[model samples]
Target: MKRLFLVLIPLALLAGCLEVDQHPHWVKGQYAGKKDDLPFQTHFHRDRLSWWGTISNRNQHQNEYNRANP
Candidate 1:
């Protein structure tokens, strides 16, 4: 019991520090399945049931431009 707690505690703390590196150009649509020509700034088709696309954020200058113009 003591050994298990020691191991689990450190692992839990390390897990909190880990950040997942998901790319910006990956968007999962909300319409059941995939669709072509999403209004996102840039996009990629993922399989056939989803699309990977770019989203505009405070730091994404180009994405902001697309949103403003589109």
Candidate 2:
């Protein structure tokens, strides 16, 4: 049981390290196993933020048009 626990624990930690919470483009361009991948990290969060901003702008523009016509 002790041996099994040791092996499983290491495997779980390895799996955690493999997982990254960022876009592939960001990971490849910015991170990519470089030592300076921390401070310059821009990934899925940035992508999502930009997307949300675009959507909000579009919605605001649509509302303005509707108000002007109505």
Candidate 3:
């Protein structure tokens, strides 16, 4: 039991140094992804009001209070 403790104690202490640096390479305000567009720009043809109404109605349907009342 004493030998097991001596081996495990040092092994556990040195295990943390094996980790590689995982920080992102881009931190200087330059995006490295593809260009994106608004959700409603293509589907709803840039109709913000219609897109907002759809989102609001979907949220209402998912509400617990609205479901219990109905």
User: Please, what is the whole-model Cα lDDT of each candidate in the order they appear?
Assistant: 0.55, 0.66, 0.88
lDDT of 1 by residue, 1-70 (tens): 9999999998999986779876444447444445556433244433333332223234465565666955
lDDT by residue for model 3 (11-34), tens: 999999999997555657875665
TM-score of 3: 0.51
lDDT value, candidate 2, whole model: 0.66
> What is residue 21's positional error in candidate 2, in angstroms?
4.5
Provide the TM-score for each candidate, comma-separated: 0.29, 0.28, 0.51
- C-alpha lDDT (0 to 100) for residue 13 of candidate 3: 100
List pairs with backbone clashes in candidate 3.
Answer: none
Off by over 4 Å in 1: 21-36, 39-70
Q: Residues 1-70, candidate 2, lDDT per residue (tens digit)?
A: 9999999998888887876677544564575654544321343343666767777788988886665965
Ranking by lDDT: 3, 2, 1
Model 3 deviation from native, Cα RMSD in Å:
4.0
Question: Runs in model 2 with CA error above 4 Å?
Answer: 24-70
Clashes of each: 1, 0, 0
Say which candidate scores most in lDDT. Answer: 3
